[model samples]
Target: MTTVDPTYAACPVPLPESERVLLGHGAGGQLSADLVTGLLLPALGSAAPAGPLEDAAVVPVGGVDVVISTDAYVVSPLFFPGGDIGCLAVHGTVNDLAMRAATPVALALAYVVEEGFPLADLRRVAASAGRAAAAAGVAVVCGDTKVVGRGAADGLYVVSTGIGHRPPGAAPSAGAVVSGDVVLLSGPIGSHGTAILSVREGLGFDADIASDTRPLHRLVAAMTAAGGTGVHALRDPTRGGLASALNEIAAASGVPVEIDEAALPVPPAVAAACEILGLDPAHVANEGCLVAFVAPERADEVLTAMRGLPEGGGAVRIGTVADHGEPGRVTVRTAVGSRRVLDMLVGEQLPRIC
Candidate 1:
C-alpha cells in the first residue's frame, strides 16, 4: 500500500492534476495564475503573501516603506537586437520596482555559469550590466556566482534583486485601480517580442525591429510627480503582454476594463510580423513601456508629463475602467464597432522572451 501525505489529502481545494510542471506555468498567463493560487499558495500555508500579488513587495522597515523585487533571466540567444541577458537582468528588476512607484536605490546580482562557458563572454555581459546599472542610477552592491557541470545549466543565467525607497504618498497597486480610471499606454507595443522572435527564427521584414528593452524608472517618476495621488496603478506589459497585465489589474481591483482596438499603438513592423505569425499584438511582450491607471481629472497633465520624456514620447490614451460590468471582466471595442471579451494569454506565445 502507498502512503499519502496528510497535507495534500486534507486540503479543501484540489491541486492541478498534472504531476509535472509545464512551460505555461512560467508564461505569466492563466496557467501561471492557477499554479500560484492552487499549488504554491496552498503549499506555502501561512507563509504566503496575504493580498493580491504585485510586481514588487512594499515592506515597512524601520518605519519607512522599502520596496524589493527579484527576477531571473533565462532568455535564450543571450544577445539580441537591442540588448543582452545582462543588461536585461538589470532593466527588468528596475522596471519591477518602478511599477510600484518606487525609486530604485541598489541592486544585487547573481550568476550561474555552465562549466564550459567562455570567460570573454562573461566579461562582456558583466560590462553591459554595469553600464545598464549606471544608466539606471543604481549600483550592484552585492553578488554571488555558481558554476555547474556542462549541460547542467545554460550558457549563463542572471538573477537581479532590486531595493528601492517608496515615498510616503506613493502606493500604486493593481488593486488600487477604480472605476472611471483612464488607461494609458506609455508607447507602442509588440516591438520587444517581435524583435526577439525575428532574431530567434531569422525572420526578415522591411523595417528594422529592435527590442524595446530600456529602464522606465525615470518615466514613472515623472508620471507620479505630475499625477500625484491620481496615479492609481502602473504595470509593465512583459511576459503575457498588455492583455495579461490588464486582466490582472481588473481581477485584483474587481472592476471591468474596456479598451478601444483602434487606439492600440501597434508599430508597423510589429503589426506586419504579428499578422504573418497569426499572433495578436496585444499578446506580444514589451520591455520599455508601461500601462497607467490614472484618475480622469489628472489624465491630461499625466499625459503631458509622459510625453515630455523620450521614453514616453508616444504615450496615448487607450481605454477606461468601466463603472459597471462583471467583476474582473475585460472587453475590447473593435474597429468595426463590435465588442469582444479579452482574456489573458492562455499559454506561452513566445518562450524565453526576456
Candidate 2:
C-alpha cells in the first residue's frame, strides 16, 4: 500500500502558492475566500455542502429547523465608543442566527484571557455580555474561561455560539437568492471600522462616530412579518464590509449583483474619515449593518418595515441581483455613470478590523 499526499489526491484545484497564513487570510477578503473554495472545501470533501455556506448552518431534526452559529471577537482595544468585545460577541452570534430568519433563544460563551489580565476588567466584560444577551432576550446558558501566557493571547478574546429556531414559512438561504431580486442595505456603513481606527489613531472627526454593534433579531422579525417569504437572503457585512458580503452572496447564489454608488447610505463622518485615511468605504468593516436580497414585489414593504425600527432607520434599497448569469461577480455603478467590477480585496486593507 502507498500513502499519498492529500493535496495531490483530493484537491480539485491547485492550492495557493503561499504556505503561511497572513493577517489578510483572516480579513474575510479574497485570500479568505480562496482558502475556503480552494483548501478547506477540498480537505473536508464537502465540495457539495448541503447548501451555500451562509452565516449559520441550518439543521432539521424532528421536523424542526434549528439554526446554529458561532463567531469569535478579537478587535483591538476591547472597548470602543458604542461597544466592546463583550457586546460584539453577543451581537455577532445573534446576528448570525437572524441572518437565516431565525429567532435566537440561547447562547454559549467562551473567553480566552492573557496572563496578568485584571479581574475587574474580566468582570466588566462578562457583565456587558450578560446585559447584551438579556436585551436580545437570549440566555447565555453555558460559558467557559481559559487563561494563557502573556504572549500567547491578546488581553482577551471571546467566542460565542448561538441557537435559534427557524421561523415558519421563512426559507432564507443564499441559494434562494435569485436574479432580479432587490438588494437592500440596513443603515450606514463603515462606522464601526472608522470608530475603531479613530480611537487607535487619535484622529477625531467632527461628529462622534461609534460602532453600530447591535442585535438584529427583532428587526429580522419585522421583515418577516412584512415581507413573509419575500425576503430571500440576509448577510451581515462584518469583517470585509458591504463589498465582500455582496460578493459572497453572488457567488453562493450563482448570480451577479449590481450596486448603485449614489444610493449607498454612508454616514457623513464615516465617509469623511475613509476619504482622509484612503480607505474604500465599501471594503471597510461594519458590525451592525446587513445586506438584504428580497423579491421586487415585496421590497418596498420590507424596506418600510426595516425603516420603522430604531436599529434600521437608514435602510435603503441599494441595488439588484443581475438577471444575466455571470456568477461570482459584482458590479458597481458609480455616480459618474461608469461601472467597475467590485472585486474582493486581495489582502486586508485593515487587519483585525472587526
Candidate 3:
C-alpha cells in the first residue's frame, strides 16, 4: 500500500495573492504549487486540495482512494464537432489520472486570453468546462486568469488540473504488466485525430466526424471494481495514440506485445480519413479511450466491466503481452494473418492537432 509521507505538508509553498499566473506556473516545480495554494485554493475555498502536488494530485477518500489530474487547453479551433478544447482539456487530464484507477475528485482551471478575444467565446468555453466537470462528478474548485497583449497569444488557452484518490488494494502501473497478460481497448479509435484533421484540412465528408473527448474515470473505476488486481496497467491512447502508448508499456515492462489488426476497433469515418491521408488509425490519437493490460485469467472480466460503461461500450480484447521475443519489439498480426512490426511514432503526424 502506498502511504503519504508524514513530512508532506498540506501546502508546501508559501501562499501569496497573485492577480495572474506567470509562465513559471507551468514549470511543474515549486512555483506551480505556490500559485495553487497561495492563490487558486484560497479563492476556491480553505479546504485543502488532494493528490501529489506533482503533475497531478492524489487524494484519500473513504477506505478506497482517488486521484486528480489537470491539463491545459491550447488546441487551435477551440470548437470542434463532438466537443471543444475546453472540454477536451478536462477529459484529457481526468483520463490520465483515471488510468491509475483513481477516482477523480476536483479540478482547478487557469485561462490565458488574448486581449481582443471575444467575451462570448470565453463564456462558452468556461461553461463547457464546468458542465464537463459536473458530468464527470468532479467539481471545479479554483481557477485564475490572465490577458496577454493582442496577437501575443492565441485566442485563449485553458489549463485545468485535477485531484483524485486511488482505491485501496489497486495496483495499477505499466510495470505490473507481465507475460501472458491480455491487452484491451476501450472502444473505436482515431475519431479525435480524424476530427481534428478534418477541421484543419477543411475536408468535407458525408459523415459528420467529431472528437471522442469525454471523461473515463467512472469506466476505469468500474473495471477495477470488477477485476480487482487483475487490471495490471491502463493507459489512455493520447498524443501518440495506441502505437506509441503500447511501445512505452512494452519497453517499461520488458515485455513483447502482439496486437491483432482485425480485432482493433476503428470507426468507419476514422478509417476513411486515415485511408485518404495515408495515416494508420492505430497511429492516430484518441482523447476519450484507453488501453488496458490485464492478467489472462481476469481479462474477460475486466473487458466486460469496461464494455458496461458508456465510454467503453465497444471495448475489446485486442492482444497479449509476452516475454520479449525480441527486446523492445511490438508486433501486430495484419488483416491477412501476417505479423508486422509496429514502430514508435518518430515525428509529429498532425502537429498541434491535440
Candidate 3 lDDT, 16-42, residue by residue in tens: 445555654532222433555555655
Q: What's each prediction's TM-score?
A: 0.94, 0.93, 0.81
Angstrom error at residue 346, model 1: 0.9
lDDT of 1 at 230: 95
Candidate 2 displacement at residue 121 in angstroms: 1.1
The CA-based lDDT of model 2 is what? 0.84
Q: Which candidate's TM-score is highest?
A: 1
In model 1, the worst 10-residue window by lDDT is: 1-10
Superior candidate under TM-score, 1 versus 2: 1
lDDT of 1 at 102: 95
Question: What are the per-residue Cα lDDT tens digits for candidate 2 across 1-354?
Answer: 001112223334646677877788778777776666566666676553544577888889789999998887888878888989999999999998999999999999999999999999899999999999999999999999999999677799899999999968877777688878999999999999999988877788524799999999999899989999999998888887888788777877778899999999888899888988898899888889888999999999999999999988999999999887477679999999999998766686688665
- Compared to the true structure, candidate 1 yields what TM-score? 0.94
Model 2 clash number: 0
